[model samples]
Target: MRISQSYIILREVRFHAFHGVMPQERKVGADFTVSLRVGVDLSLPAESDDVADTLNYATLYEVVKQQMEIPSQLLEHVAGRIGKAVMDTFPQVTGVDVTLTKLNPPMGADCAGASVELHLINDKTKV
Candidate 1:
């Protein structure tokens, strides 16, 4: 089997948190969505049929949830933190892409929300 590229995704993980520049935003908080695309080499896991050979998705979620609990002034900051956390905790992770969205933003726009995306490539991924 040839696994040219492999990644795991967690889509639309929802949370309510205080993350904004405005004071009211920090006070009232807002609904948010977090999506993650995690890159890794799936060759070992594919053949071994073992969770130990692959990333632990539950651990990944805990990492994300921990970051989300921390209040930040910008989505950029939050997203970057999440990406870095994943890379730091998982040596098997090759890359991480994080997307954070604030639902029904306080800003005076009719749009659904505002978002920020961050990407990080692991320098310590195992060969």
Candidate 2:
């Protein structure tokens, strides 16, 4: 078997969501950026020129959006949820690299804000 690595990268997918330790953050919400590196085999789509042969990114966006809508106390938790959802929803997906960022954090630091990154492997990909 000729095994190779292929990835679909989704960048700067933004959402306004309630996720934090502070009450104000939960009530007012804040902007978040979600980027995903999805591991999948795209060789089929590349050959057939068919959308059905590939993982539809719009569906992946919806999955992330759904997870964001649910309130959470930590970025790590939310990111983990997103990674798991992708693995469960698409059998073709081998893994997910989730980077979730909280933009304009309530903290006084003048910075781009905080982020959590996670790499999750799909067990289904293992023999």
Candidate 3:
């Protein structure tokens, strides 16, 4: 049997502002929700009972926060960037699911929000 371990960090991230194709959007920044699911092999850590043997989630959070601060035109791009950032920052991270939600999209139609989700994995690892 195979075992999987993961954690999710879900929160609304507010930006000072400029991130969109329209001038209005750039002028009045908006609230965005960033949800991340990070997965890694925890067998070693579980067996050894050592923090050093596992990926540190606290460090991952800091990296995600830093990346969210940077403005991007498309939520898809933001999600991709965040996924890569997580993998690059944590060597132990094997896979990641990144989703970004725009609270107030410019669509005139009645809509709660728009979101995009992407999953990325480290090709080097089979986990």
Candidate 4:
């Protein structure tokens, strides 16, 4: 039997935040959705069935929540911050993908949302 890399995902974690270049957007705020994909080795946890052997997703959510609360003008910045924070906090994570969506942005044209996605690999580890 071969054990390979596995992912722990948190999807559509929504928040209302003031994150935009426009003053009105900052004042009124808007809905934002965040999704994270965290990659790690699952062999230990698969065998031991121990929570301690795997990455704790609750902790990752808290990290994302903290970053979201700090207002920023660009979703790119927010997404980058999240990727770095997750990689820094969890050395076990070999790679991370972060998606941030801003619902009903203030553009003149009708649109459902705007989003930024970032993918990062831990340089410290060979993945």
Candidate 5:
């Protein structure tokens, strides 16, 4: 018998935060979008129909919100922190992928945004 893993995803969670290397960028802040994919075992939840058997997306949002509140110089750092925090908070989660995007970046080009994606797997499941 084999057990299949499932995911709880939070897509395009937006926030206005101060995170940048430039002084003005920090002072004025910028728009940020975060997308998270949390992997977990869904066997129990599928049968029991109970929220307890799966990770709560609301709680995950709080974790991301808390991390975003803390300013960082780079999007990579923010994405890494989100992935680590989600894995630490949910014991059942086997892995996490976080995408953090900064809208209207200060680069002198016609672009929508810049982003960083981080993928982290639990140590026990690492191969």
Candidate 6:
């Protein structure tokens, strides 16, 4: 038999950034939005009501924020770094979804915005 699990979502956490391939972008950084979906075993935290038993969202935010501060040429790289960082720091994280959106991209296109999404699973051994 299979069972369903509930996940805690930290959605649409916004960050101002200077990340891009263009020089002007680095000089005049724009706003970047990051949404993180972290999957973990919550039963222990829920039953015990212990902060230590669950994922520390505050710490997670700090880790992401610090990573975003570093300038990068590609959003893909940033997203991958964020995913790896989370998995490295948190032992309970089984899966992670990272979406990085750059508002008003420099593509000079007629589109409203541009973004990239990356899904990372730590079970590299199986794949």
Indicate which candidate wins on lDDT.
2
lDDT of 4 by residue, 1-127 (tens): 6676689899999999889999988888899999999988888888889999888889989999999998999999999999999988998889999999998887876887899999999998888
Among residues 3 or more apart in sequence or in different chains, the pairs in candidate 4 whose N, CA or C atoms overlap within 3 Å are none
Q: Model 6 over residues 99-120: C-alpha lDDT tens digits?
A: 9999889887876567889888
Q: State every prediction's TM-score relative to the real structure.
A: 0.94, 0.95, 0.80, 0.94, 0.93, 0.89
Q: How many backbone clashes does candidate 4 have?
A: 0
**Prediction 3 TM-score vs. true:** 0.80
- Give lDDT per model, in order: 0.91, 0.92, 0.75, 0.91, 0.89, 0.84
Model 2: residue 88 alpha-carbon error in angstroms? 0.9
Candidate 5 Cα outliers beyond 4 Å, as residue runs = 1-3, 125-127
Quote model 2's TM-score.
0.95
Q: Number of clashes in every candidate structure?
A: 0, 0, 0, 0, 0, 0
Cα lDDT tens digits, model 2, 9-122, are 899998999999999999999999999999999888878899999999999999999999999999999999999999888987989999999998888999897999999989
What residue pairs are clashing in model 5?
none
Where does candidate 2 stray beyond 4 Å?
1-3
lDDT (C-alpha) at residue 116 in model 5: 90
* 4 against 5, candidate with superior TM-score: 4
